[model samples]
Target: MRLEEIVIDNLRKLRRLISVRRMDDAEEAACKIVKYIFEDAPVLGLDLDGTIDEAPEFFRLLSRIWPGRVVIITCRLDEDKARADADKFGVFYDELVTVRKLEDKAEAIEQTGVTVYVDDQDECLMDIPMDVTVLKIRNEGNFTDGKWLYSGRTGKQIC
Candidate 1:
């Protein structure tokens, strides 16, 4: 049988960039994703790098839709650091495993049995197993109302 599970990645990388202020499209994209999860058309995955705040709302929403199927992947470089950050963010997850190397992405996803890996960095996920499709989160373009809208906007809308 073909796989249809979701595996998210690249949150840590996206979050660490100090220059970025907010993602306007995040909520919109998330809303669409939430709808998709409820349909069960394709399973969803959530990956975090411990940079963004623990999104209780997103977790709660996904939980209501997918229940026990959502998987969260992350890397902390240090187990103690991971636990400390998990506690700090209150990230209650089915699997909150820490990874040592970047190349372990495939093995980790294999363990979760997820089909697609949604990451922001294409380079890191490029070498994963063929069965695992890697989707890079784009900065903008054709996404409609995306988080990138507010990237460089000012208080006054230029007419």
Candidate 2:
């Protein structure tokens, strides 16, 4: 089925659970919906520096929960330092890629076939194809005007 249809069905199920006042079941169903959405993604892309570095624990949890391959795509020059930091932060990833420029991030995502990408930099988030689900990590330092599919911080769905 289409992604939209699947999401709608899941929402309906969640609504039914909530209507019945089964708070626990509703919460479980909500978690399942999120898991299903991420699991359906073939690959998940994450930005290392500002995004993951700002919130290592959150990203670590996400990396562990995601059922698909996680790729850390960053524009940092020092690959060794990035690797060490990732290890120290306990963030899991299938691969770590370093791009020469922030604009190169879009190309990397396309090349890696990332269905969902999370980044704090607007430069990296822009130019990605519409087919990819772009999520913005809430970063007050960086100004991003682009509409995001979800909030990386709270996992809240956005337009």
Report the C-alpha lDDT of model 1 over 1-159, residue by residue, as the tens digit: 112233122233234332364554343333333443444344344556522233545454543445334455665567677656655654444555566665566677788776656544333464667876666555333135754232232223466
Candidate 1, residue 53: the lDDT equals 36
**Could you estimate the TM-score for every candidate?**
0.45, 0.64
Candidate whose lDDT is highest: 2
Give the Å shift of residue 55 in candidate 1. Answer: 7.0
- Candidates' lDDT values, in order? 0.49, 0.80
User: Which residue runs does candidate 2 get wrong by more than 4 Å?
Assistant: 1-40, 143-159
What is candidate 1's local distance difference test score?
0.49
Report the Cα lDDT for residue 93, model 2. Answer: 86
Q: After superposition, how far is residue 132 of candidate 1 from its true place, in Å?
A: 3.1
Clashing pairs in 2: none
Cα displacement (angstroms), candidate 2, residue 51, comes to 0.6
lDDT tens digits, residue span 1-159, model 2:
875677678788889999999986676566556655664556889998888988998998788657678899999899999899888888878899999998899999988888899998777876899999998777656644764433464345544
TM-score of candidate 1 against the unseen true structure: 0.45
Each candidate: how many clashes?
A: 3, 0
